[model samples]
Target: METAYTIRKMEKSDLDQVHEIEQLSFTVPWSKESLLYEIEQNLFAKYMVVELEGKVVGYCGVWVIMEDAQITNIAVHPDFRGMKIGEALLTFAIQLSKEMNAKRLSLEVRVTNYIAQSLYKKVGFTVGGIRKRYYTDNQEDALVMWVNVQ
Candidate 1:
């Protein structure tokens, strides 16, 4: 049988596992304190997690502000990369944005991250602009992408 996974709103209890995935997936991962603040204090933040076999394996975060939504970050456990979890999570974010009355959603990806760009394109995202040296880790430029959600 194929493995099963579920996507749901994130909870404080999942922080440890989410932090682990974040660390494994990004060169610059958010701190545990930062995650907690986003979940508890940030009014615009909406975060979701994908669980596989009862373990948190991936997460996506977005900030919805009035008519515009911004995708802050998305990540999957490196071992779970090929399972379409990222696609599902992004779709969920778009649907959530729609429900929140957002007219558009946008995100920034490292210029070198073609894999992520392709996935975003699959979900209807197109190039919007670019940010110079958006990533501090290696000073990589970022490609801004956006999609109409309404």
Candidate 2:
């Protein structure tokens, strides 16, 4: 069956659903308050959510400054993994970054997260470097990846 979903800018009302997805997808999930701050207070933040059959299934956030856009976080509901929703979210972020005049987009993924790394590579992101002990949860190193979006 074909998967149908809508991607749109995240709003305050979406935070509860987004937070649920975040908790399901991440070992270190962002708090609802943090998401609220990103949507309502952070000027550099741009966030989007994907709704599947009217339920929020995934979300992505980025911080754009000057010519650089840094992906803050991305997650899809655990029940929705392997459905290419993460890929779609990343693609949307790239296009949004380009429209905002960002020439480069970067994000860090856990070195052990081969699935996420593969998705990033498929989207043109290359490993730029490694950030030692980048993940606070287990002190795992992170692979810093970047792509030219312009």
Candidate 3:
């Protein structure tokens, strides 16, 4: 079910490939500097990269605190969209969260992102609530989603 991919903790050397995947996956991607800061400054943050044949194709990140794991972002290269790579990355994130003793996982998804919603649902996330004006660019509402790890 994992295809040919392997998930491992992210490293500084993964920045370039991660940037490319981020750009390809999102309308407004996080800046490389911001990512670097997260890696360097966020003690709660845990990031992982998905590799296939020794090449990075996707990544997922979360911040674990007490009983919560807050998913920050996840992305897969455009060319690999239909390969179940996103689900694999998310599974890897969830396993990492459990390893860190998190009791739950949470995230915010744009209301219009049905594809992503489906993926989250497949992984056991459920719609929990909404945040108004969650996206600055389009004033889109964000659907809050959560999954209990225990």
Candidate 4:
């Protein structure tokens, strides 16, 4: 069954939950302060959150520049995993990128994260390249996946 949820532009107040999900979902998470900067100061960055029953359950960030949009992060709360929220968030991101007039949308995912890679592949993304030692904590290679939106 599809979950009822709301996806909206992330606000300053969402930093706590967003950061919480970040910490829970990644080996090296973005700090609350950095998320605040992205919300308030980054000109090209757009952050969004997904709420389930009025509580934030996931978030995604993207930097849309000229003809391209790059996804910075996307994660669902640990408790909410497998509810399809991440896929919803990703679909929203791709649509958002197209609405922003970006011709392509891309993101870097740790090569070992087959779950996320499969989700991206389900959404028309194809492996484009690799970033050597892209993850700081484990020195893991990241696969660059991209989809043409235009």
In order of appearance, the predictions have TM-scores of 0.97, 0.98, 0.95, 0.98
Q: Estimate every model's Cα lDDT from 0 to 1.
A: 0.95, 0.95, 0.90, 0.94
| Pairs with steric clashes in candidate 2 | none
lDDT of 3 by residue, 1-150 (tens): 656778888888999999888888887899998888788889999988889998899999899999999999998888888899899888877888898999999999999999999999999999999999999889999999999887
Estimate the TM-score for candidate 1: 0.97
1-150: candidate 4 lDDT, tens digit per residue: 677999999999888889999999998899998999998999999999999898999999999999999999999999999998988989999999999999999999999999999999999999999999999998999999999998
Q: In candidate 1, where is summed lDDT lowest over 10 consecutive residues?
A: 1-10
Q: Tell me each candidate's RMSD, in Å, in order.
A: 0.9, 0.7, 1.4, 0.7
How many clashes does each candidate structure show, in the order listed? 0, 0, 0, 0
lDDT by residue for model 1 (1-150), tens:
567999998999999999999899889999999999999999999999999999999999999999999999899999999899999999999999999999999999999999999999999999999999999899999999999999
Error of 2 at 142 (Å): 0.4
Q: In model 2, which runs have C-alpha deviations exceeding 4 angstroms? A: none
Cα error of candidate 4 at position 65, Å = 0.4
The ten-residue window of minimal lDDT in model 4 covers 1-10
Residue 114 lDDT (model 3) = 98
Q: Over the stretch 31-141, how does candidate 2's per-residue lDDT look in tens digits?
A: 999999999999999999999998999999999999999999999998998999999999999999999999999999999999999999999999999999999999999
In angstroms, give how far residue 116 of model 1 lies from its true place.
0.6
Model 1 segments beyond 4 Å from truth? none
Model 1's C-alpha root-mean-square deviation from the true structure amounts to: 0.9
